[model samples]
Target: MTDPERELNFAREIIGQRGFRDVPTDEVLGEAERLLNGWMAGDFRMERPKLYDHYALLLLALLQKNRDLEARIEALEARDA
Candidate 1:
């Protein structure tokens, strides 16, 4: 018979050794969270995306950066035009 607790601990240790890190729920944004859910559910066609915690956070940051840049550019154009 397998001890569930022991098995869990062993699995956690293996994950740790494999460089798996935890991302808190609060740290994940809505879009990234949705993306992660879809990725996990295999809802996408073609190649699967990297949906890890770090990847999610990075993607969110990139998206925000893109939004900010676009807004700034639009404001500058409006002011100049």
Candidate 2:
């Protein structure tokens, strides 16, 4: 598979293994920052920079979605209580 596809598949595997509902927002943001920093530092020697950028963006989007779901859950719980 291509680099972007590989990266996305790896991310999916990690999220699936850990269960996305159990993953904290900070952890997701940290992963995104790590990816961005690695890209900035030229850590991926063979992959193009844009690939990492896309990966970072994907993580950020996931983070936002996670936060939104957390908020909704909290609201539902509070309403039920």
Candidate 3:
């Protein structure tokens, strides 16, 4: 299972990209929390979107994971430098 906090963060990132313009950070964060909670409880099912939507979600997850890995790598490199 994925870390809950990580899943929440991922949901927030995805929604933010979907456009929550001018919305308060707290509101967005709350939405992410709600979504994460629903998903964890298996109450977040929805109709499938276009193929692009699926791909976009996958790519976002991959990019976020890559970014996290890159940051860790950079930190290690600096420590060893």
Q: TM-scores, in order shown?
A: 0.37, 0.40, 0.38
Model 2 — TM-score against the truth?
Answer: 0.40
Q: What digit string (tens of lDDT, one per residue) describes model 3 on residues 1-81?
A: 444443234433446555544544455445545655676686554223432243454454556657878999999999999
Comparing 1 with 3 on TM-score, the higher-scoring candidate is 3
List where candidate 3 sits over 4 angstroms from the true fold: 1-49
For model 1 the local lDDT of residue 32 reads 52
Candidate that beats the other on TM-score, 2 or 3, i.e. the better one = 2
- Whole-model Cα lDDT per candidate? 0.45, 0.57, 0.53
* Ranked by TM-score, top first: 2, 3, 1
Quote the RMSD, in angstroms, for model 2. Answer: 7.7
Better of 1 and 2 by TM-score: 2
- The residue ranges of model 1 lying beyond 4 angstroms of the native Cα positions read 1-51
Clash pairs, candidate 1, are none
lDDT of 1 at 35: 43
Error of 3 at 80 (Å): 0.5
What is the Cα-based TM-score of model 3? 0.38
Instruction: Name the best candidate (by lDDT).
Output: 2
RMSD of each: 11.9, 7.7, 9.2
TM-score of 1: 0.37
**Clashes per model (N, Cα, C within 3 A):** 0, 0, 0
